[model samples]
Target: MESIINTKILVVMTILALSTGLGSCKIVQFIFGDSLSDVGNNKYLSKSLANANLPWYGIDFGNGMPNGRFTNGRTVADIIGDKMGLPRPPAFLDPSLTEDIILENGVNYASGGGGILNDTGNLFIQKFSLDKQIELFQGTQELIRSKIGAKAAEKFFNGSNYVVALGSNDFINNYLLPVYRDSWTYTDSSFVAYLMDTLGGQLKLLYNLGARQVTVFGLGPMGCIPLQRVLSTTGDCQEKTNNLALSFNRAGQKLVNDLSKSLKNSSIKFGDAYEVVAGVINDPAKFGFNNSDSPCCSFGQIRPALTCIPASTLCEDRSKYVFWDEYHPSDKANEMIANEIIRKLGFLYVNGTNTPPPAPAPTHAHAHAPSPGS
Candidate 1:
């Protein structure tokens, strides 16, 4: 009971902090999505290809040990949290994560290989799809309600921020794979429409769960990733795949704007990761990257390792390479992407309101931080 009071106190204090301009108060995040945003959720899955528990995965994380993040260091989500003075959300499946921790520091449910469609990652054997993620969040919502009653729980949940970075697997792992039924089920345009329809319902579910401030990241250049490039005979980006991503981003951007208005008091912003990361990929030197096509970690002669094995070739300077593996970016590239997205979204601020002074008013997400518990 005492622990519950402390939990409630923490929630109230955070709400008061945001409402009263207490800069020191911790901003918690409820994170979702896939490997890009996954901290360590996949590691907990028993039989999963969504694993990133091996060495060198988190070399730059804390003390040079893998912390379950797919990248070499922080993800785009991690860097964005740092910029906003928000705490790093622990993996939802972390044994150490309790109800107290959930309400306080928040939790990340993002899983590698997970996608909008449930069957998207069937090859992985185990993964939490977006629908599964929402179901898990409902459990978290229940825990919060138990701790501080329904009203206070609503206040806390509504005040907290949310981040969702997903949908990549729906293309590469699902629609593109001949083994999957979705490939033959829908054409390119129809597939994206199916994805958007699923994603739209997912976002609506989140809003129903008190997700007032959400950032839905747009897909980047899929054709330029090390995995996709290796498949190209000319060793160049596949423009056709890129155009498909643009189709999704176009419809996705519309969804963000539409949801922003429909979900009363909600601020659903679309992070323009497509343009930001493409800038780095197109002109690598401009962003301090020399080799954007090749991955920092390799499996020797193989274009893209399913996941880096123990015997994979490691690059001398991970920072110089744009990609860490076939699918994900290196720590340096993630930082570049995160910083640019932050600039566009504009959550960081010096004053109590936490608004970006230099950035243009974000046309997508809410420009001003919504009042806590408003």
Candidate 2:
């Protein structure tokens, strides 16, 4: 009777351990990028032009609060988190939150106006450079280890998903602007190559810091932005700008592919957001987008100097528009882009290992949940 009782206790302990290990397998998502992925980091910067603290920003979020997200609703990162069965990562600057927030899913280090280069621009002077974001990601990983354990943390990151969306500001706001265009004396090709080198170094840095799976988004068509259109002749997309974006995308693709080969055991996937976005612009109706060239907000004879605001005439239906403003995509557009990213991630995440279980359905209600797009 004593031996049997001891065996039962051992069985209970084993079951507890197994349950703990299984629960620890929660997948963490680390997002790094610019305005496209920024949740609320821009709000931390006082007097920063990158601020998104306004109503129009989160009109579809139901909260009716901006949250410093530069969109009519959730961005691609939010969709990725939803698809991964994790909550949208809280901003690193949210003082109300604790490390537990990060351990549950992950942390978002993305900030609007952030770029690969430290000396990028003036909009958000205090924004985290790509290198700094990666460091924060490392810190988050350490926190996860403390909360869970080293082995669990390792497993979490080993099978984790990393999404990086950036590079538009580097070209549109920094390199191409007259202030630096003459000062830097860099042609489009040289600028792209420089960006590629720096970004590749950053990817390698993340890899060394335990990022085994990474998805890098290439540059989108910046020429078609309302800001660019207003600045160009004929009020159309500047061919030169589009060419630069394409060049950057091509180079970025090569960089990600080469990095995968160099890293050997690591899996790095490149999402062709450039091509996908360009497709929507080139063929809008096919993707359920109505206006692809012009922004849905602040339309008409407004000059590039004007900003999209409440006073501006917003489109009646944001879902039909690809771009919400000058530099950001609408929620509908972001959902499409996010879906494409997930498809690519599926290939990378399930490449050599057993497929991860499908993410459970979301518990909380989202105002503008992601819908299927081409």
Candidate 3:
């Protein structure tokens, strides 16, 4: 009788533990955005103006093979996917990927120099804009429906998390570009309003497509980048560019909050990238970084006038630097940002109450480890 009672007690404990401990259950992540989130889509596009599949780009990655990632190693997308128990999805443009694989695992449609508007990244003629990425996502939805039936596809869409980390290029590559100078036509506030309107509509379209959990990342401090700093006469961060980024982040935050309330079943959070990155930049030492202003792999006196090239000087300790090139963050910087963002994401997904678990956890099925009682 006692043996049977103990057996029953053990079973009950196991059930309780499993229910509470299986935290990172969601595995599929549908990522969309610009170069910050891009893995390798630009590699397949010959006409892409922002190519990174070259020396000094992936110098820190395994075997130093440039895998089309803009940074010296993994991007924030790759790190976040790791923490979420998700396998890094292949770029949609990867010719070797099959339809079956894409349906089973989500596809990454982010492109280098991509933006919210079709004309935003026009300098990169081959870049896929937000509208184009969404259209491709719709195609992905249909493919899933055709293969697994409508009900199954709907379930998958609802279960998966949608991530959008775009809009930076809309300002940097379009509004600020001398050739385009879209900002010249309107005040900063007006430009921000226009971007918000378009972005809100695109987000609504995504909700209509069945994304119950969506995370939208706001713009970082673009003015602090080496490229922007080099352009300033005083060699300091341009106040105008900084203001534009701030305006965009503020608008994005409000948009995400409004969408979360209106969508009813959806949970959307605006990743305050400006705040997170600003903190790191203000005190690089706190984040184990020695230099925040200079590029780790670019030429010139901290403020390089060109992109990282094959002959560019490389930093001995990549972790000591914050920026990898004139435009992007170092792999270590990305790792720090990814860790902080994942914690924020964990809190968002867990009903906004608890602190998130630590990083470097196992991936995929291993994340769903058995409970102690079991």
Per-candidate Cα lDDT values, in order, are 0.81, 0.74, 0.77
For model 1, what is the C-alpha lDDT against the true structure? 0.81
RMSD of each: 9.5, 5.5, 9.3
Count the clashes in each prediction.
1, 0, 0
Q: Mark the regions of model 1 whose C-alpha exceeds 4 Å error after superposition.
A: 1-26, 349-374
The C-alpha local distance difference test score for the whole of candidate 2 amounts to: 0.74
Higher-scoring candidate on lDDT, 1 or 3:
1
Model 2 misplacement above 4 A: 1-23, 84-86, 181-183, 299-301, 305-307, 344-374
Query: What are the per-residue Cα lDDT tens digits for candidate 3 across 299-326?
Result: 6564464567765767767778888888
Sorted by TM-score (best first), the order is 1, 2, 3
TM-scores for all candidates: the values are: 0.87, 0.84, 0.84
Residue 260: error of model 3 in Å?
0.8
lDDT tens readout by residue for model 1, 165-235: 88889999899889999999999999999999989999999999899989998889998998899888998
lDDT of 3 at 272: 67
* Top TM-score prediction, candidate number: 1
- In model 3, the Cα lDDT at residue 200 comes to 94
Question: What lDDT is reached at residue 100 by model 3?
Answer: 61
In model 3, the clashing pairs are none
Model 1 scores worst on lDDT over the 10 consecutive residues at 360-369
